[model samples]
Target: MNAPLLEVQQVSRSFGDVRALDGVSLTIAENEFFALLGPSGCGKTTLLRSIAGFEHPDGGAVLLGGSDLLALPPNKRPVNLMFQSYALFPHLSVAANIGYGLKREKLPKAEIAQRVDEVLETVGLTAMAKRRPAQLSGGQRQRVALARAIVKRPRLLLLDEPLSALDRKVRAEMQLELKRLQHEVGITFVVVTHDQEEAMSMADRIAVLAGGRVQQVATPLELYRNPANLFVADFIGTSNLLPGPSAGQHLVVRPEDVRLVAPGAGRLDGTVADTQFQGGTSTVAVDVPGQAKPFLVTEHGATEAVRGTPVGLAWQHEVAVGEGLA
Candidate 1:
């Protein structure tokens, strides 16, 4: 493989005595949609800001396109950051705001206008170029901010929870728009978000971070199916973390992976404890005879199980165990 477009080597950051990032390192390929996913205060945003030149790392170097980025100022680096709030100038029109970066470079009026028009078209904001930020809806304002960032044609774009402020429907719509925009522009996009659903839906590869360290980096499906550790298994989706011995390590299995069989058909026997119906699927909690807590089982098209019903549970060995890598 060719050298990565962005290389973060042993990056570490601290605030007095507290460590925000601890010896974090990762590489990002050109034109890839990468996501830094973690819970709040896990240092995902700190890592993004470090890459964007907003926060200076005390320990390691950030390299972009084979060049050290530490020596360059934020404005000189080939990166643009789109903040969560959209950060649009309230007084400026959409077109003027999109053209702000180009104008600051001392480019000629014709060139700035030309580039602004092109980006407006790219982001589907040409029709509302004259409208101020307040005149547009949430989605339109987000597009304008995106156009402004991309107008400079930076080599990399950093997004910090860009869709978190929007409603669920709009957020889903913007996810597709962001993906389409990335393909059309063909630039590297690194988004930092705590929402697992957002990362799973949009990222080509996701780096799961926890407690200021990276836990696992893999495609969404791979991370969901084959997690490297217990944190990843529980974080990526809903899973039943059973304290059963396997290969000298504790095991965890997703609710869907635990299959309910006829009585005396499986190794574990349980009594149904509770049930929750969620549209097409239902979840049933079973109290295993030897276990202290109830285990959850997710079944589709079968919601008839009631509390106190005897049942057998079994799961495949592969889904029950994950290699212990924390």
Candidate 2:
């Protein structure tokens, strides 16, 4: 990672006895794509708002390039938040929408036009520059919002579920588009999202939050392979969390790590209960004798195993999960 560009230290907040953020601390690198990922009511949005100057944290500090960002108001802060709504003016043209911020600062009309034109090309909306928001598709509108935000050349870009409004196909396309735009703009991105796939696919690193606290912060691959604790194991990706022999301990098993063999050859005896065939992979659920929940196994390509087939379940390795990791 590059040198830290944004520092959030022990930030705390409350909503009349409901502690929203509890001593959250994070260091975001310059030009890195960082995600604040969590389920609803986990305070990720609050954290984003705090950084954007929309919500003042009850405690701790926010620093940008070693300067006090908390002291500045929302408009004065060197950051821009691209809301999920893509709040573009219905009556304004694409060029006008992108140039609005420059107009607010009273920049020269020629300069505004130049910047707007640059970003219009950057977002691939040059041909639609004269079109209104209603005249654009959902993805194009999203680009307009992004272009508007980046045209200001803010130091940081905060996005709150920026792709939530689009359909699945467009959302997937926009995910790559967002990464491209981030790299082209060369700005630090702090995206708050509840979608696990979105965070995993786009973010260079992700801070998984839950219950108003950070569960773990790691790259998507690292987080998936080695979760810090039980909560993280249960949250980041799909895991078959089996209770351990002792209390406060659990086994974290990924479906891919599970293998099936003839009965009595592996550790546990079970029958294939169900199979879900995805394009290139088949997920097999096994009903073990003593286990309350079926163990899920992922098999590449089409699996020949069908329901009622007897098999033994074995693990590639054992990962002992404890409660004290946090």
Q: Summarize candidate 1's per-residue lDDT along 1-326 as a digit string, tens digits.
A: 33489999999999998899999999999999999999998999999989888999999989998899988999899999999999899999999999998999999999999999998999998999999999999999999999999999999999999998889999999999999999999889999999999999999999999988999999999898888888898899887665545554546777888888877897578899999998889999998866767888999976888898999988887776464433
Model 2 scores what on Cα lDDT? Answer: 0.92
Give every collision pair in model 1.
none
Candidate 2, residues 1-326, lDDT tens digits: the string is 89999999999999999999999999999999999999999999999999999999999999999999999999999999999899999999989999999999999999999999999999999999999999999999999999999999999999999999999999999999999999999999999999999999999999999989988899998888778888888887777767675776777788888888889988788999999999899999999877888899999999989899999887755443332333
Total clashes in model 1, counting residue pairs 3 or more apart in sequence or in different chains: 0
Clashes of each: 0, 0
- The C-alpha RMSD in Å for every predicted model, in order, reads 2.2, 1.7
- Per-prediction TM-score, please? 0.92, 0.96
lDDT of all the models against the reference? Answer: 0.89, 0.92
Best by lDDT: 2
